[model samples]
Target chain A: MVVAEFVSELRARFGIEFKDLSILDEAFTHSSYANEHRELGISDNERLEFLGDAVLELTVSDYLYRKFPNLPEGELTRMRAAIVQTKSFSSFSREAHFDKYIKLGNGEEAAGARQRNTLLEDLFEAFCGALYLDQGRAAVIKFCQQVIFPHIDAGEFRGISDFKTALQENLQQDGNADIHYEEVSITGPGNARQFNIDVYVDDKLLGSGSGKSKKRAEQAAAKAALVGLGVIS
Target chain B: MVVAEFVSELRARFGIEFKDLSILDEAFTHSSYANEHRELGISDNERLEFLGDAVLELTVSDYLYRKFPNLPEGELTRMRAAIVQTKSFSSFSREAHFDKYIKLGNGEEAAGARQRNTLLEDLFEAFCGALYLDQGRAAVIKFCQQVIFPHIDAGEFRGISDFKTALQENLQQDGNADIHYEEVSITGPGNARQFNIDVYVDDKLLGSGSGKSKKRAEQAAAKAALVGLGVIS
Candidate 1:
């Protein structure tokens, strides 16, 4: 349940031993702990958490993109989001038994903050940041792919279907529908141009949407139409 | 044009020729072209585009995340968006002179569609997808590092400063002004709590923010207060 035990478990899980356990210690130390023990001279996990969040997102995103070459952009983005979100990160932390190893102040421990999602997510990010700094991006990438990507890939069967494709396919299948996408208006000038698109199915307005581009607007309109028709959840 | 000529041109710009030019041609072919020329028995670039988009995002996100070890999530997310956006994809397509090689239908060509953002973006995505499938993930990562990562890295020096640090340093130096963050509300169920936090200086509310956790909310509040006080642009 101590920080040392946590590092041993993490090392076993990640297959990388810490050269400086101080990095791991700092990563597990919350600001509350620092606040309570001012003389510790240890920087809290906030900065490391901040760095690790980026590192995690990047590593996971790269891995998924490479492995799943057939997935669309929106699907990839959502998958990356699902993996990096607090909920996912917390699960990873919990699986790592993060609560057992976190170094919290007496006040925080008294407050019963061991299972806090915020704490878990921050700790996971901090851990990732520490791993990256100590081992390198390659190690971080391998750790993430091993620890996180499987959960995301497993969820691919459920809760993560391609909404864009679903919408497009549904529209196309409806009596071989002739979907007319018109750029109704383009507001603003230069990079600010907001394209408004109206999707018509044989002159009946299926949906309307606005985006930076007419194609995106059409895609949005298609997405809205799918929601309107209960084609996508 | 012959596939050899096309590969050489791409090699000049992309610096990597395909072991097979079929992938590149497959990437360049649009659905409209396939529909028009049924004899070619070739599928369009949509599937490849979908795949490529994922590869592009993952590659760019991975590069950005590792390249800048200390950037906050928001800034990193924004940078990812900027790099993988339609505009960026279009630029990439232009750089490769994709306009000259893309196989579009007569109707699309008449509509000046070769220069279209959607078409260019799709072509770029397809190109990536084809490259990934043909050469593998390692090749894609190498291509991304050579083609996309450098551009993203160039923008890194512009907008990735730590807002929280800037805010704290500014407030602390101003006659020892104590900065405080308090959680105003904690809503939702066990795992999905929404936290609202307010940043205060001497009992005066500087900024408030809401996030999935208190730490995030505090960071958001700090970010807002920094911008509000003109501590960061």
Candidate 2:
């Protein structure tokens, strides 16, 4: 009944009713809540998030592939990441006022966890999963294209910029110093490792960065070095 | 000039003109070719692939967000992964005969490189990169929605299930086993790492897999185990 009310509110907001109420509820429910308080028989949104992640990626991939016929996969993937990051999803949750509608455990509520990026992102993921299951791909695609793509497209005219490269060039011109990158450490195993890189000038550590790969870490480190040097905006 | 001709050929095939011919060339140029001969003064597709990966993700993310009005992020990411993974990309490239079109070093060319999954996937990514730079977002979105998503949706509706969970479920059912995942070790200093995981049936290793993450390695192990058990078709 509570779930139905929530769905009704969402439907009223969007002017569309869902065929499956369970999907809507699942989208709003967090795993932590379900884990801590299982007696309510309320399920977590992890599975939905899992499913939603895939659905979201496919939709984004397809849109980019067709929309920017000249764009390659790597650029397309990055653009997708920027739009689908935890922060982005959290913002979407806020825009939709989804956090206000989420069903949280007392602990989560007391902890003021409803506004958390992690939670909001999870909720968004859960929602996608539900959409995929309840309304199918076509419906899901329709919803995403109508609501989300515009925001991303609005930023499509961004100028080509590389913070790290600019930073390096500035440092080189300032003192004729050779920029050096050294790997400090790596976290995670195999393909998931987060590389830590330190940028040094004349044997002095200027900045550090962490990323899923050495090059990215180096770029991040360079980017930080640039910021430290006040070389980039 | 050569790049322009290549773009024309691609345009003929995909029915889209290159907004930036250089982007198309980058998509077609393999890293091996660059590594083998620097005299060409040509950069490889690796960087383009890197950029395309991001672009692809963002494009898909944006599409999913609006298309699935009530959908979340997790499912969207997963679907994107399914579409972008080497297997899927390779399949798409193969179907499109992208391998025959890619410009490879003689060494790679002689090694049956045209049939290589990595090459095909890279080319696909490069193509996306090119698309984003050339025709902008609208064209890419149209093509992707028409081609990729439809196929996945069609396959999905036809009961094309995921391999990861199926393997996990089968493993869990044997003697009520509790599967544990661990990221044993990571290699390299940064974003690059090879993950190793051991899937135990009962504290005894039933399967072992290696990939970029415990999840991927576990999935790979699960798939291998399934193959060994004749569970995956």
Candidate with best DockQ: 1
Interface RMSD to the true structure, each candidate: 8.6, 12.4
- Give the winner by TM-score: 1
Write candidate 2's Cα lDDT for B1-233 as tens digits.
23555556656766887655666776788765654554555667765665565456555655554544322234445565666688877877777666767887777788888888987887877777667667765676766775566775464521313445555567667667676555456555333446676665557665667864334566666666667778755
Model 1, TM vs. native:
0.55
Flag clash pairs in model 1. none
Model 1 Cα lDDT, one tens digit per residue, A1-233:
13566667767876778777888888888877755554455567765675687667667666766665545455666666767778878888998777788888777788888889988999999898888778877888787777787776565432525434555566777567776777687787643567788877778887888875444566677777777888664
For model 1, the superposed segments whose C-alpha errors exceed 4 Å read: A19-84, A103-113, A129-146, A149-233, B31-74, B125-233
Candidate 2 CAPRI classification by DockQ: incorrect
DockQ for all models: 0.08, 0.05
TM-score of chain A of 1: 0.67
TM-score of each: 0.55, 0.46
